[model samples]
Structure formats: C-alpha cells, structure tokens
Target chain A: MARRPLQEINAGSMADIAFLLLIFFLVTTTMDQDIGILRQLPPPVPEDLETPPVKKRNVYEVLVNSRNQLLVEGERMDIADLKEGAKMFYTNPNKDPDLPILTRQTRGAVEENITLLQQALVKDPKNKQLETDLKKWKGKLSAIELIGEYDELPTSALISLQNDRGTKYAMYISVQNELSAAINELRNELAQDKFGVAYSELNPSVAEDKPKIKAIRAVYPQRISEAEPKDISGN
Target chain B: MSKFTRKGKKGTPAVSTASLPDIIFMLLFFFMVVTVMRQDDPKVSISKPNATETEKLEKKSLVDYINVGTPIDTRFGTEPKIQLDDAFAEVVDIQFWIKENRDRRDEAEKPLITTSLKVDSDVKMGVVTDIKQELREAQALKINYSVNKGSALDNN
Candidate 1:
C-alpha cells in the first residue's frame, strides 16, 4: 500500500503569468513628462495702495486681445517675433544719448529720496504737502532710467504685460513665455561671454561658480510686471 | 543516410524555456522603472498649447497640479471646470489646496512648492487669472504653466 509521491507544481507557467502582468502594465502605463514656463506671481496689492506710474519709455508694454492678437509697444506684432522684440526692448544696446544714465550714484540718490519721503509721510500722515512731495519722489525713485550712454540694465527695464479678459489662456501664457525667454536668453549670453558657461549650469548648486552666476543674473534679472486685465472693448 | 536522418529528426529538443522566466522578469523590471503611475486621472479634457520656451519641470515632488478645462463626463456639463486632485473645484478652493499641500511638506521643502497650472489652451484667460490671484493670496507665488513642446504639438 505505497502512496504515490506528490508531483512538483510546474514553474514553467510563471513566465506566462509574468508576461500577462507585464502586458497589463504596458497597456495602462503612461510616461508623461511634465514641462512648462515658470513664473512668479506678483504680491497682491492692497486695495488702498496705488501702483506707481511707469515712464512710457521704460515700459515694454505687451498686450493680447481676445482674438489672440499681439500688440507690442503699441505696434501690432507677430507672436513668433515677440522674443526678439522683447530682447531688443530690454537690452536697448544702442543707447539713446538723450536718455539719462542710471549710475550707482543715481540709484543711491533715488533710494535716499524714497527713504526721506517715507519718513516724512510717517511723521505727517495727513499732511497734504508732504504727501504730494512723497508721491513725486516715489515716482522718481521708481522711474525706469533709460540711459543712452550705457546698456540699459535689467533692473531698470520693466516689462508690463496686459491682456483682454477674453484673451485665450494659451495666448497669455505664450506671451509670458516669450518675455521670459528674452530675459533668459540675455542671461545665458552674458554667462557664456563672462564665465564661459551655460546659464543653466551656473546655478547655485554649482557651488564653485555660484557667485559668478549670481552676478550674471543680477545683470539680467527677470522683471515682468503683469497689469490688470483690461476690458476687451478698450483694447 | 538513415544515421544522418536520425540526427536531424530529434526535432529541436523542445526549445528550452528555462530562461523564459528570466527574460520575462527583465521585461517586467523595465516596465516598472519606466512607468509613472499617474497620481490623478484627469476628469477634464486638456489639450495644452504649444510653446517654444519650455523647461522640464525639474522637481516632480515639489509640483502640485491644477487642471482647467471642460469636464469629460457629461454629468459635469460643458462649462470649464477646475480639477484639483480628485475632485472638481472652484478657483477659491485653490487657496486651501495650496495651503494643505504646503503643510504636508517639510518646512525646508515648503518654499519650493510650485503650483503647476495645466489649463486647456482654449479656456479664457479670465479663469486662469482668477486662479493666479487665489494662488497669490495663498502665498503660492511660484507657478508653472504646463505646455507641450511646439514640435510635439505640430506632429500631432
């Protein structure tokens, strides 16, 4: 009365099982790569506060309408040419001799003026005379200095973007991307010229060259100021 | 002739399957490594606009997505809706969502959180602007507009 030995289960079918699972995953899996234009939103303005006026020459105004038309600096522009136009406007390499030079001294004077105005306002919050003077000095300090003698620094070049409320989100984002590209393009060019390195490689993670990269960024900072959306009819 | 026929007649000796599991295992690992389990199944239809100047989102963990488009489900109707995580949300819900996401991160990593807006290209700018304002109110200043590469969209 001998009992038959138990038969070993086949391992051969394991491959088939694995293949089935693999195929299932292959069918369901998606390898989507996320990519996009990065931007920082400006701080919310207080209801009672006023946005200081930007001198016409210093502002690189870009407008997008509901139809996705681009109006750059009051001229109808094609979306394809936006990057080059923005770059030229911001760099202004061919200085206009009539424009005032934005030197270290001028910046210092502007800062001093602002501080004095702030102190005066604090002392006499309700004084009409001080308030008027404060507003004037504030405008001067915040003015975009367009110097003909030197290349316009990024700090003084302001990009003002406005869009119609009905503008497509795509167009609005595209414009922003182009403007950012202009700034980044300038920074990369400067980085390559000065440090012989690509701008992306000049990041702070590259500890040895961080300072040099920081200097280059300072020369070509991104200064996009998004204005409130205007009514489509106005555009 | 008969001896030569016997050698050829062995009939391929039952093709060895011993290594079949190993080969399958290798394939399994390959798929596992390449697969990115989607965190959220988009309920809304999204066709991102093409753009020339896009950078690959470097840190995946630091990004939280907000999808804006008309819902795919008929139940939700045709009006454009914002999808945050798993559910439909209003623009105002963005503030709390951002705060919750930020709080979940380590203190040092919280500042690096970026709100990735995956808005359908056809959606009006007004909706996106509202979301941006909400994000600003929540102090989530870093934002990324998700876009496909121009060439990729063209190929499609």
Candidate 2:
C-alpha cells in the first residue's frame, strides 16, 4: 500500500494567538512616570564640631507647626504667599537693612582677593583650606564677570526650614515646592537677561551651557537649610 | 475568436491574509520592547503630593523606591506604614535595605543610586523624617521626594 500523504496544519489561528498576547500586555503595562523634587541631605555632623554662628538677619526662618500653620520670618503667612516672600528675601533688590545683606563686590576686588589667597597658599603650600578658598574666589570672579548684572551676591543669607513632627507631608512638600520655585524663578530671570534663555532651557549636559548654568546658580544659590524638627507635635 | 473571450463564472477572489500574522507579531514585539513590567506590586496605597518644581528621574535602574503610605492589608492596621521592596518594614530596616540594594549594583553606579520616597500626602511628617534620618545614617544622601506635577498654590 502507498504511504499516506502528509497534511499541512492550519496557521490561520496564529494571528488570534498573537492578538491575545498583545491585548494581555497592553492591559498589564503601566506607563506611570518617575519624577520628583531632587534633594541632597547634609552629611551627619561630627560630635565634637562647634555649631557655626549665623546672624539673625541672614536667616529667613520658615516654621510650620503641627496645625500646618506657616510662620515666615516671625509673621503668620499663607502658603500661597511663600514664593514671593522667599524671592524678596533672596534678592533684596532694594538693599533693605532688615533683609539679608547683599555684598556688592566688583571684579577687581575678587581678583585682588584671589591673589591674596594665592599668596597665602604659596607660603603654606599644604594648606587645603586656603586652596579651597582661592578656588571659590576664582569661581566667584568668573561668575561675576559672566553675569553682566549687578555684583550683589547674598553674603550669608539662607532659608531655614523647620517643621513640627505632626505636620502633614503635603504641607511640607508645598513649602519645599515654593522655596524651589523661588530660586528657579530668580535663576530664570538672570539666565534670561544674560544668556537670552531661561535657566531650565539651558542644558546642563552640554559643555557650552554649563558655565551659563553655573553663573546663574552662583548668582542665586539655593541655601535652604532643613533643621531638625522641634517637639511641637500636639500628640 | 477574440483573444479576450468572456471568462466563465467564478466566485470573487478572496483577499490574501498571509501577512496578518506578521503584522500582529510586529505589534506584539513593539509593546514588548516599550513595556516595563511592574517590578514590585506596592502593598501600600500611595497618593503623592503635588509640586510645581518636579524633575524627571532620568535613570530608572539607578533609583530605589521606599514606599510610605497606609497599607492595603487591613491586618497590618490603618496607620501609615513603610514598604521596602516586597514587604512592610520598620524605620530601622531602611539601613539594611539600602546596603542590600547597594551591594547588587555595579561599583560605578552605586554612588549614583537615588532613593525615591513615595509617600502619601496625608501621612504625617514624622514618618518621613524618620526615613530621612535613616537614609542619612546609611549615607544614601541623594533622594527624590516623588510628587505629581501641579501648582503648589493648589495644595493650599
């Protein structure tokens, strides 16, 4: 007897199988993004170190109580008004004596200061502290020259954020967002004036835009200091 | 006889579907490449707070998540709990978790790892503070407070 002829299996159902898998994956996939406010925490302080003294005028104190009430610079303030208040404190455009002091240093002065620090380093070549100071002074000089605006730089001004343990997380984040927005707003203005672009528009990953970003940041540095929470919880 | 004689009656020619499976497979592969499978199903329910100044986390692999919210499991109680990886964890378990996470990464990428805190808005600051303190001790200084993009003024 002759051998039975071979029969080909149907492949018409393959599309249906693939369709089932595609639907399964489409339903199961989550396109949620990962985004947030980036922050760097201060390192643990050493036990034997002495606390540095900060002047009352130099610190913009922001306190949030257990009830989520905001006390900004010893005055009760609504959360909505925080950004404007922070911008005022940082910029001090009017040079108000009550606000943080802004030291107007010219390019000549910074260059001279850098020379003096360098001369001091020459005497004690191994002085790491002096070397760092020189480097910082040089950076300031570049920043001052890069930004053609006024030489007014916040000498010692910083925002001190303090909160009660019972404060709601949403309130805390709101405060943080305001503070960040304040700095970013200032940077945007400065970047717009100097570089003809917003601060956020400058790509930090690019080599040409690095100095522009650094200059803007140097002009309005984010000096928010998050202090340890006090025992103000109602519970 | 004409070269073009009338053809005999015949049924309509069927449209070829030989390429249908290939097209489906192409779509399947597209979804497979673009899809990021959920790594850990969060046991805690999280509703992130809103913020205006949020930055997109660039590298997902370099970020380790610490979820803080009310647990979905009622047996654990309604109080805000910390979820590390697959299970609920205490504040103290953070250090060990950080170490384990660090050990699994490449040496060069270890320092770049960021700890993203996915905390519910309604949770108290105390729990968040405790986690931050533990993170500082663990020397995982870089952190991202995960939040949705919205106006801070709207929060008030």
Instruction: Specify the highest-lDDT model's number.
Output: 2
lDDT of 2 at B22: 98
Off by over 4 Å in 2: A1-17, A20-24, B1-14
Chain B TM-score of candidate 2 stands at: 0.89
Please estimate how well model 1 matches the true structure, expressed as its whole-model Cα lDDT.
0.78
Chain A TM-scores of each predicted structure, in the order given, are 0.69, 0.90
Instruction: List model 2 lDDT by residue over B81-153, tens digit each.
Output: 9999898999999999999999999999988999999999999999999999899999999999999998867
Which residue ranges in model 1 land beyond 4 Å of their true spot?
A1-9, A97-156, A201-203, A230-235, B1-9, B151-156
TM-scores for the candidates: 0.78, 0.92
Candidate 2 TM-score over all chains jointly: 0.92
In the order shown, the candidates' DockQ scores are: 0.45, 0.71
lDDT tens digits, residues A113-205, model 1?
878878988988989987887775454443323211123353445788888878888777778777877888987887676668778776678
